[model samples]
Target: MSDPKLLLIDAHALIHRSYHAIERDLTSPSGEPTKAVYGFASTLLKVIKEQQPQYVIATFDAGKSFRAEQFAAYKANRPATPDDLKSQFARCQEFCRVLDIPVFALAGYEADDLIGTLSKQAEEKNLDTLILTGDRDTLQLVDAKTQVLMIMGSTGELKLYDDAAVRERFGFAPEQLIDFKALRGDASDNIPGIAGVGDKTATKLLQEFGSVEKIYHNLASVEGKVGEKIQAARAQVELNKQLVTIDRAAPVTLDVNAARFGEYERAPAVELLRELGFQSLLARLPGDGDGDAADLAAHAPQDIESKYAAVLSETDLAALVKRIKKNKAFV
Candidate 1:
């Protein structure tokens, strides 16, 4: 009776989060690192169990983005990806493949762009979309037809942001976040906005002026040192706007029907889990009766711990603990 829900996953965000959150040095039987793989699988399964989305799509960052080309210092502040974690990305893709979830990655674009494009496509098809990511950059995509399911770091807590939630948090519309970031800049991504503007100033400016373009048009009305800073960084703010705004027109196509959930081969999934030393997750896979999304939704929501307890025996829990304890180095 309700509109179908499509879950859009930001693979790089989750993978990065997982790599940091899982402090252990998890490895496969043959000694390959798998902490990122384990954490990603755990989080992914937890989302699927709780949301029961009718369709699912995952997006990954292919390589250097156009933003990096436009601005040489784009995300230059971040450290290089660890060799162990870098190796696990392919494993994450393999995990998605075994589950039959379609993944999109464009060399010239980040995963955010792919998600923006797909969410817009899903909206046009009359499907409701839920974007799952740890990155707040995707918050700008929240609208009536699309919501952002943001995963808090290490804690693994999820906060869903709809139109009202976005407005309530930022004191402005979701789209205004771009303008906010344009004024305040993002240290994580190394985007330098205005010279002396901070969060309070940016928020106040956006609350009154609406957008970067509007603020520039009404520069005379904006007085004081803050106004001077805005005037000084006019060109940088325009470039920041370009950097912060998600690309909704990314060159990626979405076939909604192909993304249908609960259609993967159960046998390969089980084997893959075994190979990766994820014995506990084996019980979480869908059984024959779970072929339909309606059937999955009919069941009441259960947290990851409850699901594991209901399906796994004490021996399984002990083995899981032992496997975790065996790892020493931090990821």
Candidate 2:
């Protein structure tokens, strides 16, 4: 058999994506908002079914990250999490709990760091890791033993990025993504890299120089306005490297047995889904072996030949209507 695979989920990323993907008015029977919860659960179940991972772990953002401490303006550009969405985080955690999936959330580290730490540990155990997230920052962690399952927000498409795939998309190795971000900057997270350096310049610089430090070391060789921009933002680029790189040494321990998938109590999960008014999702639960479960199996992405495929099913359509009450919300 193939080596067992571990699925490391970026809970915050999926929760945030879910909040925006589905209508905000989706709620539980008692009127508590559940758009995020439903979307997260649906995506989580979809991944578990598609990947058939033997182990699974979900990571969440607990509080301010070290990036914020290092750069006061880090991620300062994003607005505050809405009150409705904030309340749904606990429900997502609860869903993970009911499924017996271990949830990790460190106060000073983002979910990305936790995933990095866990994937590194999983690698040492000779296990393959599949990181599922909407964040491109995690692409830096991709390698032979580790790959990223990226969810496209616009089309809700899933794309798997191996080392080769990363190079195909970014024109450099996955490890070089940090340097690319350091030179190009990420406006979403408020990471200010070298000013005026865009994607092409950044890619060209990294492809030629390999890294930020080396690029600066060979500064004399770099000429023109781009060179001046790099020289001017030397300190900022250095800081951005620290901000962009994921910390693989985070202070979280991985209990391999605890993360073993398919060992949870099905009754509790079934009840929780029912309580959350996720009736259509009830049959999709792992090991359900029911009517729609077989149908759900056929909808999983069969291979990696194509970067994107439609994984939705008739049951999903029915669920979308049951949850959002409007077909347009999914579109």
Candidate 3:
């Protein structure tokens, strides 16, 4: 059997990109701005149709990330979220609720951190994991069992990166992405790197010396003013490393079973889409758009009563063993 695929979405990244991509505002029936909502919904449907993942979770950014606490100016350059797009965040979240996907966010971490934590957990379970995000910083999370689907363009063009793809794109392995970003600095996040280093210079430095530490260690050997620039910004380079690294252990606790994707009622979902004026998405609902009660009933969340439980006593254990034996033929 094929390995189960878990699709982890960076909700904030998608919503922000979707909000900015369109020139004109999109509004719902009541005139609430909904371009972000519409864009997120469309992306979700497209991913579902194409990837057909068996497990899914959408993660949103928690308030201010710990980075902001560490460096007050972190991401300070960005303007406030546009009110129109900000208003649509809750609607997009509700759409996730209607679709029965677990929504996750922690108090002091960004969506990328949650994804990193879950990706680690999924790695332990040996599941195939895919991260969908517009943030390039998430490239650090790619590994043997994990892949990042970087969403590009208004149409959500996906650039899939495994370790090999990351290497091909950046001239280094996925593991070096954090270090590369640290040296280059992320202007979008207001990070400061060496004074004059750009992507080409950063790439060349990494390719030659492997990492920031090594470059500094052999500062004398590095030729040119770029080497002097690296020495001058040593403190910023170290700080940037801390800022760029994704914390895989982000104090997130997930009910792994609850996160497992399951069938959910199609009627309510379609109803929500219709209410949102998403006629284009109504056709993609699980069943025909006839609003059949039977279809809804058939797809109701699985009851916990039928699930196996821990045997706390010998008698319970004996009963459970017998039940397992009884079902052995089917297995």
Candidate 4:
């Protein structure tokens, strides 16, 4: 590929959004939960054709990680994936297999961190990286070299976000979104932020002080109960920042240039789509006149540098280690 353009799709975010957006309980021709499959397929095609990315890869949660041990309440509020949707992730992977897109996952980090690591590397290679995520937290990755294509609608509209857009939306710079999140806490991830802060208040405060550290360093500069409240919860805000910040430097054993996109053809992809009862999505995929062709067409894995070595190396790992105090950490 001569031009450098990469598209990073948030696999779990796509599936979760798909599961809820196309809320109809859909079963395949063989009776499988196909809503997510359909949504993922449709999204894949749109990204491939519209973004015309030179390289592409999707990241998923490996399910085993130390994030839980560092803190038990991380993501504690997201209700369990319904039995129905939980049943479909494997079939979704099968869909990825049939498409030939290089699917990746890692231990000790969520998909966002993987995407962040990949985006950082791509930027270094002079490649423009676009992150396709439904989660707002990934906005932290938005910069000149990276674009966050957040799925904004049920049918197929994407909110393309760059640094400017991130700045405009939250009144805080894109890099500062993590800080805003750190202060207010994220209920979705089960983070209990300062008691009274919400989005509006969080944005307002960050606009003034800039970051969690600054807000603390200059707490006396603020006014009203909010200032008193902030000082009171200073300890919690620091912890939230740690939780909300995606470790962009997380050690990765893979490469972005070596990522393959060969499976998105028109034939077998269509066959799999047909098998999954994803007719609406099938209608939207890259068609080969006769269909059943995997629309994706690139392939291979690349070697990635140790992006997280400085912060998460073996020698530094023990600093965050703690015994898993509960059984649900694994569940």
Question: Between 1 and 4, whose lDDT is larger?
Answer: 1
Q: lDDT scores for all predictions? A: 0.88, 0.90, 0.84, 0.77
Worst 10 residues of 4 by lDDT: 292-301
**What are the clashing pairs of model 2?**
none
Per residue, candidate 3 scores C-alpha lDDT tens digits across 268-294 of 787787678776777665535565444
Pick the winner on lDDT between candidates 1 and 3. Answer: 1
Tens-place lDDT digits, model 2, residues 222-294 = 9988888889999988988999999999999989999999988777887788788887898888985564464
Q: 1-331 in candidate 1: lDDT tens per residue?
A: 1589999999999999999998779999889999999988998888999889999999999989999987899999999999989999999999998999998889999999999999999989899999999999999999899999999869889999999999999899999999999888899999986777878888988889899999999999999997888888889899999999999999888897789988888878877887888877876875553433333344437664532333278888787677668975323
* lDDT for position 290 in model 1: 43
Residue 13 of model 2, lDDT score = 96
Candidate 1 — worst ten consecutive residues by lDDT sum?
289-298
Better of 3 and 4 by TM-score: 3
Could you tell me the lDDT of residue 313 within candidate 4? 77
Give stretches of model 4 more than 4 Å off. 1-3, 153-156, 253-257, 262-267, 279-331
Error of 1 at 12 (Å): 0.2
- What's the ranking of the predictions by lDDT, best on top? 2, 1, 3, 4
lDDT of 2 at 151: 95
TM-score per candidate: 0.86, 0.87, 0.84, 0.81
Kindly provide the TM-score of model 2 when superposed on the true structure, using C-alpha atoms: 0.87
